[model samples]
Each structure stands twice: as C-alpha cells, then as structure tokens.
Target: METEDEAVQLPFVGSFDRRDGADALADKIIRTLSFDLQDFRRGQRPGAPKGFAYLRERVEAAGIFVLLIGNLGSHHSALNVELFRGFALADPVAPFVVINDQDSDTAWSFTLLHELAHIFLGQTGVSGSKAGTPVEIFCNDVAGRVLLPAAELARQYDLRDAPQAEVISRIAAIAANRQVSNSMVAYKLFREGLISHEMWAAVTSLYRQQWLQNRNAARVKENDRGPSYYVVRRHRLGDRLLKLSRRMLTEGALSPSKAAAILGVKPSNVYALTETAA
Candidate 1:
C-alpha cells in the first residue's frame, strides 16, 4: 500500500443526478483503481470477509476510511443517533469515510458501497434524510449494481420457468455464495422484474427479522467472552489504521502518547494495540 503522504488524489467538484451518470462514474472509478469483478470475488472467501481489507487498503492509498463501532460507546457513539449511516466528506483536505460498524455484514457492505457512490458523485451530507433524493437513488442504483451485477443475475436465474419458491431459493443460494444478505438479492431480483414488489417487501422483512434474532443471540453469547477488545477493535479501526499507527510508533515518527490518542486508548495500552495486527 502507498504511504499516507502518497495517497492517491481524487477530486470531486460537482454533482450528478442521472443513474447513467452514476454508472459512468462507477466505471471510471473501477478503471482508475484497476479493479475488476474478480477482485471483489477473489477476496470473498467462505466464512471470511476479505473485501473490507481490500477496500481499506485502497482507502489508505487514497483517502481515510473509518469504521466507527458506535453502539460500543467510543467517540463514534454520536452516530447512534441514527439507525445507520456512512459519510464521505466534500472538503478536499478532509476527504474521508465514516461507516457505522454496528450493522449486519451485508448491510454494512451496502452502506460502504453507497458512501463510495457519494464520494464518486460528490454528494456530501447526512445520508439519513436523503433517502428518496435523486442523488440517493442514483447512489443506491450504483451500489446495487456494483454488488450484484444485473447481467449476472439475469444469467443465473430464469424467471420465466422457475417457480417463485424455487427462485427465492436460488436467490438465497446466490446470496450465500456472494456473502451478501439475501435481502440484497431480493432487491436485485425485484428490480429486474423477476419478483413482485410485494414479494420483495415480504422477503426483505423476513430477512431483517432473522438478522435481528441472530444478532440478539450473538449478543448474548458475546457477553460470555466473545472476542477480545483488540480483536473487535481491529474490525472497527481497520487494518490500515492499526498497522500504520504501529509502523509510526516503531519508526519513532510518533510518541506512545500520541499513538494512543490517535487510537483512542491510554498510553499504557499502546503496547496491546500494536501487539497484534488482527
């Protein structure tokens, strides 16, 4: 990865409203980053999410990407005011990303892509209330397409002959393979006219309910000893930030106090922070 001082420069000076505009911008970004569909898929190993690391590396190369585990009571707790959010700054000097980490992996993935769309579209503001806005809609379109390509969906499931139940089953299978929530698959299928809006609503609601139940169960289990502080923090702060902080500390470019402050921990905890790259 490139050094922070050598991060790539991406300048956004205007806005766009058209879906075509969003698609065009998405294409430009993929080309600029030399990213392909395989890069997204290759990192997605079974039971392991490697894409976030890939995204984090690129963010370190070109911008700041923050994973704020708000509900856990860190400085990011302010984000709990909203159910979820991901923001991209418009200020050129402060170009950065802040994504809520207290969501399901699928939801978080979508939010990340949604914010990336905002960065590409130069759309900067609180994302909570802009749901139906053209910019938001455009970003949603971009995000959905990026995660689950329309062409791939069309080729995988035949809406003409497959029964609705079978189609839903196929959707779930595909979603599992892709490591995204089935809700996303339902949305894509609905958009493709392969499923009814009613079906989409029902399926999305069902998945959300399942996710809630699973989360509650996991929370109960987590209270018993779940992951260590640093392990969880690794995901919240991301590998790029943690590794960079450790490197600076080792090179004498940063003091223990400053490193701890940057990492939101006490100076005494600096050693623990650098002990593992997790």
Candidate 2:
C-alpha cells in the first residue's frame, strides 16, 4: 500500500486525509490483497464446487466473500436472507464484502467495487450506513479512481466536445473495460465536472426510473421459477469429501446407500444435493 504522499501521485482524485489510522490500515490490507478484475472474472468457476465445505475453504482462502444481492423486486427471486444472516452471525471480526444489485449493471458494478474498497480499507461489519463515514468516503474515492482513473477520463473528455451522445460513448468504453455500467461512468464524469449539472441530473433520474421498473419485472420472473436451496456446510467438510464420495461409489469403495447415509441425504435426493467435480 502506498503512503498518503504516494497515493496523491496515483491517478485517483481524492485525498487520504479523511481516513483515521485504523481505516488507513484497512486500506493498506485491501490494496495488498487486491487482484486484477480481468483475471478473477475469467478464472472464477461458474458454481459452488462440490458442496458447502468446498465453498467455505475457497472463500476463506480468498479472504473475501462475493455476495450477489440480486434485486428481488425485478427478478422475483427471493432475497438471500439466509445467506445475509449467516454472514452477520458467523464472524463479527472477519472482513466481509457485500454488494447490492440496484437494478442497473453499471450501478451494480460500481457498488461491487465500492464494497471491495471497504474490504481493502480494513473495515469490518460494514453496510450502506458506513458509506457516509470518512473511511467509507475514502474507500469510495479509491474505487472511483480504480474504475475510472482521473487521467483516462480527462483524456476521454478532451476527445469529445461535450456532446451528450459522444460523452455516453466514451463512458460506455470505460465501463466496458471495467465490466461496469454506462450510468456509473456518466456519474463519475459528472462528479469530475466533465458534464453539466443539468445533464447529470436528467440522465441519472431517467436511469433510476428505468432501473426500478426493470427490477420489479425481474422479481415476478423469479417468483415463477419456484424454490431453490443452497446450503452452507461446515468448512472442515471440504471439497475432498464430495470428490472422495463419488470416487468411492465408482470404485466400489462404498455402496450408493452407504454414501447417501454419510452425506445425510435420502437416496432419491442425493443426486440433487450432491455434485462432484471432474
């Protein structure tokens, strides 16, 4: 992590004077552990490996948990209340990352990076309320810097003569690189004074309303999809348990009934609840 003096030399716009000592420490830790977005997006597996135990090991090892809080109103999917509650109760001291899908892909990506900033800053047990605090403000500043560096944005602004469509196109290009949304880029540009206040307000208002409507429609679709269950099993159980169980069944190390018993599932539901990686 760079010192305050060093951070100023970086592409970020905000100052670090807002942060206290503890917050600064958190920031350092986050910066140290941070991984490239491109690498992570490509490397991440599509689903939970094997079962709950495997999931815990991978998350604990990564030192961060990615919680995708989908908008219930738009998708009709039930809120992941259980997952949220579990994290809250599990460890008050450990770092936790939480992100909300506020309708737009752009908004969601910004919020996700914002939460990652909080993790890097070393704050624990954070939520939306903490966003207003000095530490959180610093974190937000860092996230913005990372997602849309001041230098790059300035170059883009120079390339256009303030035409709304041209500005949107530039923002879209930046968002594409960051895997974020155009609205997020637009807001960033507005904050930097590259766009007029009136333009900013109008575009933001329109985007917000559209996002709300789409989110509500998604909620209906989710409700129609019916029940889906996911479990968070003990970490000690590990991915090996799932793999070994499958191998044993194949090699005649154990009977199907015995494997089902060990896994604590009925014979019929074992296939549904248990999956082994190849």
lDDT of 2 by residue, 14-66 (tens): 22333454335334433544534344323433333222222233333444444
By summed lDDT, the worst window of 10 consecutive residues in model 2 runs over: 4-13
What clash pairs does model 1 have? none
**C-alpha TM-score for every candidate:** 0.78, 0.53
Residue 100, candidate 1: alpha-carbon lDDT? 64
Writing each residue's lDDT as its tens digit, candidate 1 over 1-278 gives 24346444556423343555756766665654455555665565333365655555555555555565556565445454244567766545445566766566666666767776776666676564667677776777777777777778767644545556876687778787564678778877877888777777777777777977997797677654566777776667766678778887787778899988878888998879777853
Q: Model-by-model lDDT, in order?
A: 0.66, 0.48
- Going through the candidates in the order shown, the clash numbers are 0, 15
For candidate 2, the per-residue lDDT at 40 reads 33
